[model samples]
Target chain A: MLAIEDLHVWYGSSHVIQGLSLTVPAGGAVALLGRNGAGKTTTLRAIMGLVARRGGRVRLDGRGLESLPPHRIARAGIAYVPESRGIFPSLSVLENLTVAARGTGWSLERVFETFPSLTERRDHGGGALSGGEQQMLAIARALMTNARLLILDEPTEGLAPLVVGEIETLLAGLKETGLGILLVEQNLAFATALADTVHVLGKGRIRWRGDGTELAGVPEITRDWLGV
Target chain B: MLLDPTFLAIQFLNGLQLASLLFLLAVGLSVVFGLMGFINLAHGTLYMIGAYIGLSVARSTGSFWLALVAAPVAVALLGMVFHVVLLRHMQAASPMKQVLVTFGLIFVGLDSVRYIWGNYSHGIDLPAVLAGGVSVLGETYPIYRLFIIGLGLAVLAALHWGLERTRLGALVRAGVDDRETAAALGIDVGLAFFAVFCLGCALAGLAGVVAAPVLSVYPGMDMSVLILTLIVVVIGGPGSLKGAALGALVIGMAQTFGQVLVPALASVMIYAVMAAVLLARPGGLVRARHG
Candidate 1:
């Protein structure tokens, strides 16, 4: 479970996240939906303490997380998979996994089982892998931390439709394990299918928060706030 | 043939000895440049510090072994001070500024050495134990030269094992590849940078102390070694261990052989080799890749 309250983030003179607030319940899959430049990414970054300048409260499992460094937050059961996927291209697929791998809930074998494509390319350099394979590696890398909360930023971006479907199935499987996921996404239909709760953000603020059942009747919010 | 077998053998040994010193100077440069992405022009100054310290200690105690052990320790401490007081602040500054600052430090370090040791070149006498020459291929070679080569090889092997096989090496590799990600993974980048800078300078110091017997210890030694080490780094590829060794050997051998075969062109041979390598691989032979 995670909570962010009245978060304000700034990049130099420009304010990116202004008074944003949201929460995810224990073992819940939450979708953060937004159009381009809506501060969705900033909110996640702020939670991870990657933002240079931020003011607000971020709590993980009812404990204060705003003051901690990214690694400390990670060690405290939070794993962040950035939008760029931050893979070390020179390192092999297995090296990438081993670099972050701690002996706990997730092991190399477990990751391989979760994403079979990764197991096949274990020795290949991260740079040489395809986009889908790279994304899979990224997710598996996050899983290596065995964090209770996994924050993924656009995990399906630039993937083939079939690959995206496979990823969705993986997420569905993860959900059955009761792993908390905060997925920042643009695909409303795909997100709505798996996310029990949805928060639509616009202009550095949360415009709406509701369950998946309420999403169908909110075309006005979708068009005006999300522009999808 | 102009290359007599005995002369060739001696020259080959000379080349190996020079390569060993070059490795000492460039390995630190490789780590500093690779991990921090900062050009530390004053690294050679740390080498000079080692030479000065060795010269002083050897002069007072009349013990080569004492100087050998004491010089690097003193220089390493100085390096730590330099990192803590100066380089740490300059990390966020522009590369050009960093270059200028470290360049300024070279002059300061050189002047400081001159003030302490005087401008005269000090000769370090090899210990009697290693003073005698050994016959190789019916040609007598200085036992000290072979010692230098052995010491250099040992340092290289130790560094390779320490960096590639240890957890510390993983942290360092990760830090160099991406500081942000390394920090995110819980590594304190500032502390790691400090520790690495000190280690790099310490290695430079070790090189200086080791070479004091063969190479004359004086103020301008830093500039000479600095230029040659820079060439080695450029030729071998920046931030690459294997590249440093290969570059050092190539330059050392070429310089020695050129001096024999074409004495007039020996001075320019290293630059020529570097230019050729750059032409082939602009990024150097080995490069760090991003994920």
Candidate 2:
């Protein structure tokens, strides 16, 4: 479970993430949907301690995370897959996986079984893999950490239709395993399909919050918040 | 021409000897720079300290082996202290500040050595068993040179194997490639950084200890080796072990053969080579994959 309250982040004089707050229950997915420069990414970065947080109370399972370093936050069981996938270009796929692997849960063998294509490309460098494969490897690496909370930023960015379907399927599988997910996505349909609750962000504030069944009737929210 | 066998053999052995020592110094330089992105100009000071410490131990115990073992451990411990006391404070500072701080440390290290060792040229005697020369291909060469070569190769093999095969090496490679990403993956990048800094200095110390017989331990020796080792790391590629090896051999052979041919231009040939390499690749012979 994850919770945030009145999160405030600033880059110099520009206020990015102004009093934004949200929560995700165990084994559930919470989708934060917004357009470019709407501060979705900043919220995640502030929680991970990658960027400076001007003010926020971020808690993972009721424990405070605002003061911890990035690595200590990681040890608290939050795995982040950035927009770029964060694959090491020089390292082989196997090394990339093993480098993040915790001692227990989501063993290498299980990961191979889950993503069979990764097993074949185990020795290949991460940079050499195709965009879709790189995305798969990125998600697989997050799993390797065995984190209860998986924080993904645009996990489906720049991928083909079929690969998107595969990723959606993988997320469904991961969800079934009772893991909480905090996803920042641009694709409305994908977000609506995966998330238990969807929050549309507009100018560093939540414009609307509703379930999938309620989203179809709120076309104005789509235009105003998401500019869809 | 390089076609002459006897001349080739002699120069080849000489090249190996120089290259091995160069590798010892450059590998640490490469790793330290590659992983932490920290520029430590005083790395060669570790080599100098190793030589003095090893010389002192060898003279007192009359055992070169004891000196060899003691020197690296002392230097490594010293490196740990150096990292914790000073470098750690500047971890978030700019590379220029890191370089300037480390550059200042070179003078500090030199003065400390001068105070302790006291302006006397010191050389560790080769153990009697390895003191003499052995005939190889109608040429007699000191066994100690071969031993240094062997030790270097052994260290290289260990490093290559560890980096390419072991889990710790995987973590190191990951950290070197991207420390932030590695940390997000649950790795303690700070711990890994400290470990690597200490290890890099230890290798430098090993280079000094092994090179003592030939180089004669003395103050200001750090500058000459530091210059050459800097050139090696630049040419070889900062983060690459193989690149360091390649760069060392290239500089070593160029320097050794240039001395025989031009004599006057020998020391500066490596600079020419370095210039040529930069003009060609800009990133060095084997650059790291990511910037």
Candidate 3:
């Protein structure tokens, strides 16, 4: 249950997220699909309160989140997994999980159960992990927050096909648990498979918003806006 | 041969003693720099404060132990006050501004010490119980110097344990790696920074209190230790405890050996080692992982 209305974000003078609006109902998986430089990531960052300059409203369950600091916004039941997968490289996987684990119901054992690869390499430093392992660790870390809403930016970016399949399965499983997810992705097929709703963004504006079924016949929209 | 058995032993002990003092100063410097990313050029002033407070407490109480325990506590409290009043305001400022502000505080601290303690160098006489020396490898060493070495090792052990084994240490380590991420995890970053700044200042004060007997208390003592501590931090690598210890030991031995074997280079030996280390690693002896 998150609603962002006419959100505007800027980096210095460049307008990033311009008049973008989106809504994710409770227990829904919403995919924000866009090409490179289409402001999908910026929208997620605005929601997390990490953007330098922001305007308009970001409401979570009817409470304004735009004015809150990143930490405060996070504490109010949102977890952000940034595009870069901001893992503390010097920390062990277990240490990363431990640092992010805040409340009950998201213990190390539960996280390990969700991502068993993390349990196997629990003692290894984060930097030493492979891309797939690191992504798992990052997702597991966000899950440890027990966040009501999880914002994932490019969750399957730069991963192998097999690993991408694993991530898809993971997302499908997570969506089944009634945890709301806002996924920023460039992959249409993967997004269609996991997302209940789809929003196509182009030039900092949302061009389309429909059920996943509508994404099938939009060839021109994909070529012009997504270049895929 | 210039290296006789007696001479070598004495040099080794001297190296150990110097290492102990350097460790005390450098670890504090490391924590302050590592956690808050604050370049507190005035940290050495807190060390000077410790010596001054030690002198005043010892003079009044006539007990070396009283000064030892009380001086650092006083300095720690003062450090907390300084963080609240000064550092908190400067947290978001540029590093250059922080440096200038801290440098100004150094001048103020030196002037305050001079105003209170006067210009004369004050020394503490070793307690009579620790005044005597015992035969060590058939060589007599001052009991106080040995005590300094032992105390330094004990402090190092305690610090290592507290930082590496405790939950608080984990929090500090997480904070140092990424302050924003640490905050996101519900850690009170501001409070942690304040506590760490005070702790670092307290260590500097402890160094001052411990070194008061060996080095006389005076105004310029701040500059003297400040320069050397910087060298240690640079050579050891920023924000590394083990690196600081290694840097201190290396510099201490270089200084001690220089004084004995090549007296002219004794003053510049630390700089030479730092230059060599920088030339090799360019990032200091230990490199912190950056995101």
Best by TM-score: 2
True contacts kept of each: 0.30, 0.74, 0.30
Order of models, best TM-score first: 2, 3, 1
Ranking the candidates on DockQ from highest down gives 2, 3, 1
Docking class of 3: acceptable
Pairs with steric clashes in candidate 3:
none
Q: Is the docking of candidate 1 incorrect, acceptable, medium or high quality?
A: acceptable
lDDT of 3 by residue, B22-72 (tens): 889988787677656788899899999999999999999999999999998
Candidate 3: where is the Cα deviation over 4 Å?
Answer: B125-129, B178-180, B184-190
lDDT of 1 by residue, B134-244 (tens): 998888899999999999899889878866666566566666666666555445666666676677777888899888888889898999889989888887777778878
**Alpha-carbon shift of residue B232 in model 2 (angstroms):** 1.0
DockQ per candidate, 2 decimals: 0.39, 0.72, 0.40
Candidate 1 Cα misplacement greater than 4 A, ranges: A61-69, A102-104, A107-133, A160-166, A169-178, A225-227, B56-70, B272-281
TM-scores of chain A, one for each prediction: 0.97, 0.98, 0.97
Candidates' C-alpha lDDT = 0.83, 0.88, 0.84
